[model samples]
Target: MAASLKMSDDKQETEIEEGANTSTNASPRPSCLTPDRQALADSIMESVKASVSKLRRGDPPTIYIVPQIIRRVKEVAYEPRMVSIGPYHNGKERLQGMEENKLLYLHSFLSRNPDHRLVDYLEAIEELKDKARSCYSEKVGPLMGNEFVKMMVLDACFIVEILLRFYPRCRKMKLVKQQREELEQNEEDLGLISAMKKFLFHSNGFEDPILSTIGMVYLLGCDMLLLENQIPFFLLQHIFKMACPVKVPHLLEKMALDFFESRSMPWNEKIEMNDSYYHLLHLFHSHLLLTPTNSKEEPNLSCIPKFKLKPNLSCIPKIKPVLNKLKNLLPCSNKAPLLNTKRRRMIPHATDLQLAGFKFKKNEKSNNILNVKFSHGVLEITPFLIGDNSETLFRNLIAFEQCRLKAKFHVFTTYLVFMDCLVNTSKDVALLHHNGIIDNLPGSDDDVTHLFNRLCIGIFHNFKGSYLSDVKDNVQKHCENKWNKWRASLKRDYFTNPWSFISLMAASILLLLTITQTFFTVFPYYRPRSQFLIIMF
Candidate 1:
């Protein structure tokens, strides 16, 4: 239990150190809790304050946002519940992530011990298999085997690893439907192998420690759960939880408030806070937090007072298609951002384009700048974007397998940053047009677009320093040009089309003639001369 406290306390300790170093006469760090419930109230307040501080500046560069794949051993394993299908008329309720993770593990365990004679254990295993299937069915309904089954198998494999390590003995029983032929009759099958042969050697899971090293890959994530059962979740949770808060809780709180005031949470739904969570927020605020990499520098809110421009619905693209899926569940995101200035804007669902053929280049002309060649036949970094430095930064936090997660995350983060830069630019252009600043625009549309891409390339190249604050305005301008061009294209397509009308008329006449010919042919004497000539020939 005290392990959880380490995250908070360590942060608090760091802040104390910072203060002491800054001021020789700085007060000593606060004492630890005395384990009294009375102190719990105060402790909770302090904790929340710390959480709030971490929220302020955005995540720190050192903060680990990387998705983790930690594996261990577990002593207790159970399938608590199964996720059911949603309403028949509508849909079925799907399994929660945690639930799916558990069932997937259960199935793997049962497969390992297929010969287990215990009725209750066998029944439990059977129930898990069903639940696992239901979970997939509810999530995807019916999917072509190639697409969805592949994903389910991967999911199951990951979950099973948790069990394999937890109960090493689970391997003795056989539970999987498709057992390996080579390792069928022996104890050599200790772990999972690459299910897909073509991608086998190159796959991230191929390097999974338990299987490649040991051969049996069935038990991976389960090992971690078993160890977790012994250590307690609160301890680990506490460590990661208070990393930011203890360091800069006050700063984080102010940042959150500032973000909320600025309307940065525009597209995201509002997050509700409970008492403990609020306390965590407070702790976050106490620490001095780094600004988010993409967050814009506030342009003297008081100096440059708020101004409104007329809305431009004509320029609005079918953003729903673009904004449907930005839903990557941030790992261990306990606190919600109070900042969301563009709430009116659409939140985009990231469509993975797997953009390839990137060329990395350095800019010695400026220490904190670099360039990258993009694939959409153009580069796309103005002042606010480039490669996936975010992934690199988070990689240090939650290390993934052989840095494959790092690579994938880099690609994803890079795409997002590029898109974000474009979006901001588009909005800025619309705003300028509405406000009559079009005449005094910053630069030519082409130049602005080119500059935006250059800036993004610089950001990606200059990971050691420089984020969006270095080039946000230029990026905004560039996106405006792109948006205007896109709007013009849409208008042209909708309003001007000679071929469409002609095609429709021709099709209607052809359909009428075909029907008339069919009716005449059935009358026995209405065959066309071409048909008689064809028969003679």
Candidate 2:
């Protein structure tokens, strides 16, 4: 009876084990998590879903933080030194000093038309707050609702006031004078009109903190041009229209350009205001492209007059041979063939190209500084000024091209890359300076060289599709021709200086005399004395 009972218990245990194995095989194992951990996972997933939905509902961001690859090369260039316009650099301690100036300008703007209250501007900004927020790439969580609206109103007012004050300076003729007189008559007691008068007429005793110092004005201009330091153009326009009693279309754009213009940076006044601009920088860039020489399409080399070598044969006797050789070796007269097989990222530097029989000429006809042309053996480029703030300007322009997604051409970036290729050392910069193609305003040749070299350090360019592709390929083609190379070698080796040319001439005479003497001696040896004399006679 005991043996039978033990066997029964073993059979029951085996049956239970078999049932558990069957259940395990039928389904997957449950998650090994406690209740709290499961709840945390669910919450994390829900947050991710909510963020994705929010992003989907948002408009495409027009303003962006400069990419790390580009910003890391020159962080200071993208950072605002004097003032911050947008939310990207709004509340920094270093830039807080300009916040008071912003408030003062805001007060001046409000004082322009007493009929338009501050609440009116606030309401306008309030209505567009969400739209404005969507223009920024990152979430402006730190500045919410009222705070954001205030920033927009204050910044827009400050910009409008500055432009108003600068308009007289831009146009100082009868029309501007009449407008000023009318404004003074209309609102002589207003702070905005008084400030404009002080800015225009009282240059010697100008008391405004921001506009008093020249360095401050210059720094403020640089800060305003920064891509990160920009408010939406529509906000600026709306605020400008409200401040000005006179309704003028594109008046803000005109005032903004006039305010920013200087000797070193001359803007094309004949700007077409047809397209919508994103901000001040975009407006400036669009005006830059409006110059007659700058075309939206690829440049047609056939239309450009082929450069003819007009060397004075009277000055140099044997230069005709060299000129003829170069003319023969010139590439096709119609257009230089594109280098389709292999991509060329760089060309020879300026000094090297000079040695390779290439001439550099300043493109004075074109106001667009980015317009560069290559034809035959001459490279024509608009003069570029390298000043204290030039790097800042160029860096921001390049950063904008790098960050803006809808930018089709990469104009500034491509021009910088082309400049970077041409300037590798101080000698290259000096060559360009001597040719009037580069105006080194504040630094040595070495500084200009370093500036170009560093401008495109982390920047990417589509070499194959660049507008300067044909220019680059033609330049490379000119440099690679065998005859041109030989002529360049001859000129560099022998005709480099007067002494070398004289030495070459003397050596050629000596060789000719030696050959004549050898011929006479060999003729006498080959034939009898009488026969050799008869032949000579």
**Considering every candidate listed, which one attains the maximal lDDT?**
2
1-537: candidate 2 lDDT, tens digit per residue? 989986985676566555545433444335765556556655665565545545656556678888898889888888998888878898999989989988877776676666789999999989988788878877765358798988888888888777776666536354345555566455443555544344333332225787767788778888889998888898998887776655446778887887777637544566778537888988887777553343223323344344566854354344445446544543222422222223354687787688777899998877777788876688889886778989988888888878774445587787888898889899999999999999987889999989988898887777676767778777776666655665666666666677767766766675556556656755676699998878879
Q: What is the C-alpha lDDT of each candidate?
A: 0.30, 0.73
Q: Which sections of candidate 2 miss by over 4 Å? A: 1-58, 169-206, 291-345, 405-407, 496-531
lDDT score for candidate 1 against the true structure: 0.30
For model 2 the local lDDT of residue 226 reads: 92
Q: Name model 1 segments beyond 4 Å from true.
A: 1-105, 113-158, 161-414, 422-537
Residue 302 CA displacement from its true place in model 1, Å: 44
**What RMSD value applies to candidate 1?**
27.1
